[model samples]
Target chain A: MPAGPTERPTIGVALKWVDLRPEVDPLTGAIHDDLHSFGCSEADRAALEWALRLAESWPGGDVDGERAEPPDVVVVTAGPAEADALVRDALAAGATRGVLVDVAPDAPSPEVAALLTGVLEGADLVCCGDYSVDRGSGSVPAFLAAGLGAVQALGLVHLEREPSGTLRVTRRLDHGRREVLAVQAPAVLSFEGASAELRRAGLAAVLSARDIAIDVVPAIAGRVARTQVTRRAPYRPRSRSLRPPAADLDVRGRVLSLTGALVERTPPRTIRADAAEAANLVIDQLRTWGYLE
Target chain B: MTEPRTPDFDVIVVGSGPAGASAALVLARAGKRVCLLERGPFPGSKNMYGGVVYGRILDTLIPRWWEEAPIQRWVTRRGTVIMTEQQSLTIDYRTTAWGEAPYNGATTFRPDFDSWLAGHATDAGAVLVTSTTATGLLRDGAGRVTGVRTDRPDGDLSASLVIACDGVNSFLAKEAGLYPHAVPENFTLGAKEVLALPRDEIDKRFGLTGHEGADFEIVGCTRGIAGGGFVYTNLDSIAVGVVLSVTQLATAKVRPEELIADLKRHPMVAPWVEGADLKEYSAHLIPEAGYDMMPTLAADGMLIAGDAAAMCLAAGIWLEGVNFAIGSGKAAGEAALEALVTGDVTAEGLAGYRSRLDDSFVLADHKRLRRVPELLMSERMQTQYPQLMCNLVEGMFTVTNPTPKKGVVALGWQELRRAKVKIRHLLRDLWTSVRTFG
Candidate 1:
């Protein structure tokens, strides 16, 4: 069926920023915690690029990890705070505008697709990674085409506007099958991972953007907040209901049996001391074992 | 009714710990604005104590608390053991006066006891906010203590008076300047471990019938440090711990965990707890330096109660302070009530708190027993004396082979003379103890 033309459309990207991880000085080994934690995500990363104008992150209450907060364009990548940072930088640099939202922990397929479809807003150009390292779920753009509304193009490498005022996009699919699509404006486009078209903001920008507060308005939902109940009582570990034939077994066998048979639910062990003591002991042990510098 | 999550009231007591929940009970019954704060997952969350309860002060507040409190057992027996280089000759007193209802002394897990007191305060209409901590104090202009600020967002609330009822090393008190300096060296730092055993085994081991418990007070097990050990019997567990001076500990270069571990490893101290699983372990500071470390009791708009006021006495014979804490809390509460009624919330208005304390057993005994900690820290008691007394007891009591020794003959007059301990010194120390403790 001579694969459908890849949709190349411009969508808004609102990049919200998160602070960089704190690092220690290598020479003196002194901890440097002075870096201010501004919830600023910049545009520019190792793996991905940001496109489209900024939009608000959906404050929608989460059902799974996916909140209904719409992303203007589904920018998928191997999860990196750097990628999120580039998206924010793109917004500040006036390249695109869209709120950067954390893909929820263990986000489900339907929710991610729905979130993308909502962002698609009928845009055909959706750019995204073919696959990712952290969460291999790369279905946001294609699934948005399937679920929300879009004609998705797989493995989009480049997205640009033509002199004739139409959008163009290129994709690779089906064992060296390369294709291009000329689509209209307002299309959903996802970029491939490692396509760093977005640039990192320099110090002057980071310091300025820090004062600009990004509001985190949680989307209110009535869904059950906690899916599991963990009751720690007397904080003492109890015997698991599943006993190994009430006898001896290898650790792997015990783990396998516990996972499979579900016979004895192993109770959580109680910690008799405070977190500091336990943490200090583990750190000390690691140092003693020559594991920690 | 799930307690219907009662209105956090004028006072929501967070902890049933002495200073905290005690304020709630005293003021609630008196009909004042108060709240008790506790961060224990429950009433006794993170609560543990050695079981030498001083009751005379407590009886005035709870009135027959020994009758109703969840005490493991009344202490009809007390065992004091002085160690030799190898063995210990012990002295025990089993007075029937202790076995009666309204026990003179009882062993308690602070969680249960503190919770019960919190409940009493609640019954008097103070709401208790469990699993909550007063992270900060709510203060106003001129540096007056107005209320407590908690860890929760928008957790700020106001009161006319904020009593620093928290506890030893109270963050709130220190922040409020109730205690500006670090707790001193004579302060007792106690670390306790609870070992669970079968109730039957516990009863047999402690030589108790059903519902009876024994407390063993120990000296010298602190490994030449200036502190002592205690073993209190519980329902199905044993509370064994050591209370020592932090300064002396630092001077001896003794790590507390090692000190406690060594204490548990002692031959005489181990059998009762041996093989029993350790359930809970915690450490707390007890105000023990006595007399000199007291902070100003009343501030512009606040009062210091419990350990905040440094009310503990580490006297050798009778070591106590919880009830004094409660009493001081009650006195503070009453003074607060009067201040609130009179619409006077200034430092001068709170002056009554100091006088109220002076009138009560809290300051009275603290002032009276000022010499106890001194006597306990005396150089003579730390050396020579305990050994001499233990040697005298052994000589008077021990027998060898077929020949039995008469008490006076076994005492060995020749050796006594050679020991260089004159009768005058004995007379002098007795006079000293009488003047100090009596």
Candidate 2:
């Protein structure tokens, strides 16, 4: 970690152009055209919001109730020309500057990671969404962490700066559990969907954002692909069994039949067993219902 | 005279509807630096219309526009349908000529059509700035309109000439003192629903094939309301709606949506739109004041066209506004070019815009059928006349074994008597219709 209370961290946010095409048409089962129109992903927006909140809340940045000198926030995205709008949206949402890396749409994850590592040279903290909405691969953050040789925290639900100038993060574990960890500066954080809500871009900010020039850098060459897919398949629907309606019966007859089917007439037997025996019985019943390991 | 300095742009046209886009296309093609401002996220995103485009104004702008643009269908059949509670009378006219090239009119969904026109304007070298609304007019030291102030930061834009193509309720025109705000009587509220159906089903039901379409003007379906109803066919959908006089609708107890619902459930209308799924419901305010409500067309460094100038003709038998807007917009562009060449953008310099409108059918048609609004809004035209017409048709068609079949004239006389209409009243309305419609 760097010296505490002496230096403010520079945060870099990774953004991506998320496709917004409807998955399927319910009425016709026909897929819609996947147009080139794209927008900033929701998870990326959350990460950007997290960075902004951290920078704004830094201590001693303001003097005598004047406007605070917030930490520098930079947004970076690597995609084709269509990603320019997404980068501009980050600028509108209060990012200090934006850097766009022009890369082919089908560039491998390692190439993207390498480009991001170059642009984020001096960034003390790097943040990105845990998974992209389009691919859902959840691998970019890991690749970036490996390339930068930085401490990586994936699926972070909460993040804040500690009093000692170290970074504190809370990772969301399965089954509604959370794990808190403290790490030094120059770390990479991938935020889950539970991160901070983003602030809206006002008209003034949007107009000013239009004037900001985005730095476009070309992609690097001589990158070997680590993975390739040879086959693709859409999600197959599971079969469902539906019981036939009792159309032959009248309303009263159907009601009686439904009541008889739903109600159990057997009486319950009282148990005079010990606590251990009762627990074993309950465990066995739960196992039969597939509710236990 | 002071020398004229070049502004940021040669011309700035506000609102990218038919008028603004048309003006931008012409000015940009003429090699003038043009900037088109639209408040919506895209051109025509905020626009809605009654689904008809008449005349060949678009053809002159974009030769054989239908081949490239997204036209719903060419209107080959048209009719006027008069309805009573249980009966209807129709006067229909169909022509094969209308379904071919150089067509008379076509149907369009405004969102697609307007955006395509704006695209052409951009292709001709116009800068289209969407989501930027002109908040107010910018004036120079001499009190002449010079530019516009938008809602964005540092969004002030200057131009040599400003064309206000804003729709019916034009805040810019009102701000410039060229015209007062329109009263309720000068406007109508139109509620429309676009119901989707299969292309083949729509063609089969409407008796159309290929790219042909139909337009039906309906009366007596409005429950005695002052305005009228309409049903227009598109390729795979139908636009069914009612236009009610704003003043009359305000006094009546029925809501506009309720009126449209009743029209959909009407015996004569329900069969035509059966089994169709509703796709969109929209309502818009139409300028119906005609020639009497037209505002001043030009001023110092400013020109107004389309609904902003009250250029819509809502006269019975001729409901048109888009063609008028296109025509007026073209004239504004040409007149502005003339004024620019002379280096005088004053009110006097732009006076040729008025002459151009006079030369075109926009002003002439409005001037000719200006009284149709009054006639259509009459109580008898809304209720008694349609009822009598439908009753006369039903009476002539109904036959009994014991009773003799009645002639058309005899059935008309008996229906007129039953509807409590005097012969003199009928003759006066007939004479008025002939004079106005002719």
Candidate 3:
């Protein structure tokens, strides 16, 4: 639904706090907080890009048009003081204003959503990354939508502005499927990292935004309790549970059996046949490799 | 023409390395709105130097900096080694005082140290703008530098004063024609590799304990190139590298890494760095011509500091740079502040920068030791002298079994004649050294 001429819609973009390059202690394998270089993550930047696009195409939203009335883009993030730089960068990238919910670095996603919920009131739509690069739980958007009682469209891979001014969003689904939905204002949309590329801010915008004061509000209490990390380990993918080769077989035989080499082996063949038969043989080989049904 | 534009910042300090950071810190502390621009992602991301940093200049800027600074190790042992392919004669000195409070010199990764110093400037109220390259100087119609133009769109920032501390290969200083004598011969390329070892392993191999470190300055290890090699200890690693003359290196077609490899594989050096894993490899250009190649320190509305001003001291016995950089940066900052207060941001007004540097150790040391760089890079110092000294030491230690022992003078003459060094050349170097360093 399009906003009335007098009413300017507001799009809220959720930026995540993450270190672009984190220094790790060689001895302890721990992150050195003082050495962290922070920047906007791809997923969060894509969400902001989606929000900007929404604002650009909205009714009376053309920047160069005579009656320019682009929707307000409010960027919000919840983290410690260092996160203020992230908000400043978003403002430089064309955010109308920025709000930093001052929260602990270890604050849970639900708590961060609760903190953002208070500051992002009356925003017509909220856009968020599918997940952050650091603490990638990706549950804040759902919690925010619940808090605002807004329609939630998660896992958005594509978004377009319809002529009628409603937002048409395509969501990624399991098994390479997509679900297209017509999203109205007052909806929470979460976007994937590849959805859009964020525009670079000129130095003029950066210089101007450097002095604009970002609203830093304290984090409200969350209903969910914080969880402690008692143990840290590198992520290990689950290994395939392969059947053991016959114990009596030789080592080479066992290796070949485990690799399915014996079953896949094909001897070189030479055939004097028509071109059509050779083409059929090539197609059959490709089919055997599962390249075709 | 239009009216002169109001300045965006009181001063624009280009490059946030030690010099720019120091200058910004001083000006910001004086209540000047300073903008510090860095081309790298962070303060020292693009910076690399030979292992140890002599940080005595930080005493005034950061009280008890040793307590909080990101120091890898305190150099408790200092050694100067003369080497041949298979032999080394080391002059090793160890003092516990260097490992204690108010330490002498330390080993640090530049990225950590540079950022830590830049953090102070920002904390003192300077706006640090990283990843912004100042492409050119913004000059007024009257040919006075007003500010800088960056690589970004609408990146023109105006300021009353501009301090170029933009490291070696500083395009800003070159654009301003401050470096009339800049040439490839005036610079040296230093390539370093950091090898990681376990803490206990490093302690055992390098004979270090409790955050103590060792630094070795090796002569005759540059494969006859007019430069030297350095091997210093970090907390859990060792930094081994070589500095080679840029012209000699290019002429010989020898890579800098091969020199590092040769140094690491040297019989004496191999024991210390054996089995260590290569953690990182970095290379940087050092401005080594000393006083002769130093750029004009000040111009209209501008002052050059740090490596951009060629303040590195590459004298043989005292190879130091970071301290000189910090020293010059502090002077530049103070001079800029005075100029701003006096409302004379002209070439003559900023002349105080030169006087301050001359009075301080930055210029005084460079001036006193100006002849040392050329002397050290001479063929006699690079090759013949090292061989003569090594053979002399070898001859002294190996006593004759059947024949009578030769006198020390006879042995010295024998080694000198065998190394093909003339007596007159050695005496000339001796007199030059005594006059310059006496």
Candidate 4:
């Protein structure tokens, strides 16, 4: 972290590269013959967008009536050489620089986390998606927070830095509830899909980003593996039986019957006969779902 | 000749379709600084075509291109089929020549083909900027086009020359006063679907071995509307679609998608694509107005090529556009080079562009088939001719018990009568067809 008011803070974004297979493939389990291009995972895009947004609103720790300068945004990812495209995309999405951690495609989660920890050492705040779209392990942010000894917030929808240097975050909870928390610097926040959509990368930025030099660092050894893939299977679509209108019914009867069947499938359970009864029903349902406890 | 560099690039090519990419490839290979701008995320992400790439212009650019390009199949069999609701008449010709080296034609999916072609341009040292729309043309004080104004921030890119290869509705050409707003009658709406099947299954169904494929062009399946249907085989997929006259489609009051669905259910077409799964569905506007709707090819510091200049040929027997685009693009490239060498990048200097195209097969073919669009889009050709042909073929093949067979000419006349076609109109159409096609 920088110390002076003129010094800009560093915001780190962890990215994951994915192989995007074409949407069309034969049902005979044959490999897709279409070309595959490199793309960043959706969750990683959301986190990067959030990091860029937060950097724009950074207060700069200024107390002398000077306008606040934006923070420097840096993106870090670990993968093979092809992952350079992902880092370039992040730069086009408004990152100041990029760090590519050289690793294999099958690098374990713990090893990736350790490499990311080394790259994000001096950053004031580090952000990542809740999980990779390809591998929904939902554990990288936790592992990274533990390795960095920083406070971790998962599923954040909103984040901003206060003038006093504390980070305010809003996490979406179940049943339309939100949890807001304020923490000190050097924290890790994992974003959910509820955050704002990523900005469209401009062509100029994309062309310029192609020229930015990506710092490639070799991976560190001695990390225990946490997971292993054992099996591979092609997607099998579930067969659904067709439910047509009854042959004996008229058109009006068929329409009415379909509507009645839909209503019966999800019948409303509670009837608000009175205020007291409604309150009792709510409380009983909450207790039954274990939310009351 | 060389001069002091004043602009950002020597040439700026708008759009990355065949024309733009080919121009960029030629210019960049000649050691000129060029920029290829595309409005899509990538080159082919926004481009669509019916599925056939006819002609050998590509061979001159990238020799034996099919060996490395994403070519789906080389067409070995091709013909047209005239269809009535329940009957059909096909005139197909197949040969081993088309499958050998220097093939006649080939089929490809645009998404794969366009990107690969653009890649060649980039490999030859052209800077390809995707997702950047050229909003307007930059003009100097004397009203000469100097560059393009894109949709990017501070995206005013200046160049000595600008080539507008943008597709049918080219904003740059329209802004430069080269093309007028297109009318509905001058355009055609094409909708296509990619149906995926197993490679072996496709090979077995189409009776093809190795990379051989077939192309079928169908008529009289548009429900009396002015259009036609087509089916082209890919490696493991079939591109089936229809091209309709926009003017007729609007009054026909039928959805284009429904028209394709009805085409898929045709008795003759259903068996070919029965069990295939739909992979992708797309639609695009094609500039079908042959030589009549062509825009001004070149002006001061500006040259228009490809569909933006209405270089597509939508004649009856030969429906082609990509080849013409590539041909015109090569001519434009050569002309631009000449203009650059003489240090006179102006309308008078670039006049060689039109002359080069006139000297090539692009202009000659379009000029010869200038009346085909009018003939193909006529009410009689769309309905009566196909109905008459199908009826005559049906009559010739059917043998009724205890009845004598009529002569071929008599049967044709009887079918023509049944289709409510007058002999005078038939004679006139035949004369026009012969004169126009020959």
- Over B315-432, each residue of candidate 3 has an lDDT whose tens digit, in order, gives 9879998999899999999999999999999999999999999898999999999999999999999999999999999999897979888989999999989999989999999999
Docking class of 3: acceptable
Error at B384, model 1, angstroms: 2.5
Flag regions of model 4 displaced more than 4 Å: A1-8, A19-38, A41-43, A56-71, A80-82, A102-108, A200-204, A218-227, A234-293, B1-5
Ranked by lDDT, top first: 3, 4, 2, 1
lDDT of 4 by residue, B1-438 (tens): 122249878999999899999888899899999999999867888888885897599989999886787888999989798877787788898898999878888898776888898899999999888879999888887888888888887677888999999999888888888876478889999998889887888888878999999998888878887878898999989989999988889998988889888888988889889988888899999998799888888889999999999999888778888898888888888888889989898999999999999998889988988888888888788888888888888888899758988999999878888999999988888888899887
lDDT of 2 at B42: 72
| Poorest lDDT segment (10 consecutive residues) of candidate 4 chain A | A27-36
For every candidate, the chain B TM-score is 0.87, 0.96, 0.99, 0.97
Clashing pairs in 4: none
List DockQ for all candidates.
Answer: 0.02, 0.19, 0.48, 0.33
Q: State the lDDT at A216 in candidate 1.
A: 28
For candidate 1, give the DockQ: 0.02
Mind giving the per-residue lDDT tens digits that candidate 3 earns over A1-293? 33455567788999988776666765566775642567657888999999988788776744344465678899998888888888988988889999988888668778888877787777889999988877678898999988877889988988898886678999999999999999876888999999889887777788778899999897666456778788986556699988999999999989987888758557889888799999999899899999988
lDDT of 2 by residue, B1-438 (tens): 222366768998999999999999999999999989899867898888885898598878888887887788999999888876677788899999999888888999787888889999999998777777988888887878887878766667788899999889888888888886567888998899998888998898889999999998888877787888899999988999999988788888789889878878888788778998888899999988798888898889999998889888888777888898888888898898898889899999999999999998889898888888888888888889888888777676677659878778878878888888888987888898888787
**Clashing residue pairs for model 2:** none
lDDT of 1 by residue, A99-199 (tens): 43345433544454554444445543444445433324555445556664445555566666665546577765788776889865435455554444544
TM-scores of all candidate predictions against the true structure: 0.58, 0.80, 0.86, 0.88
Give candidate 2's whole-model lDDT: 0.83
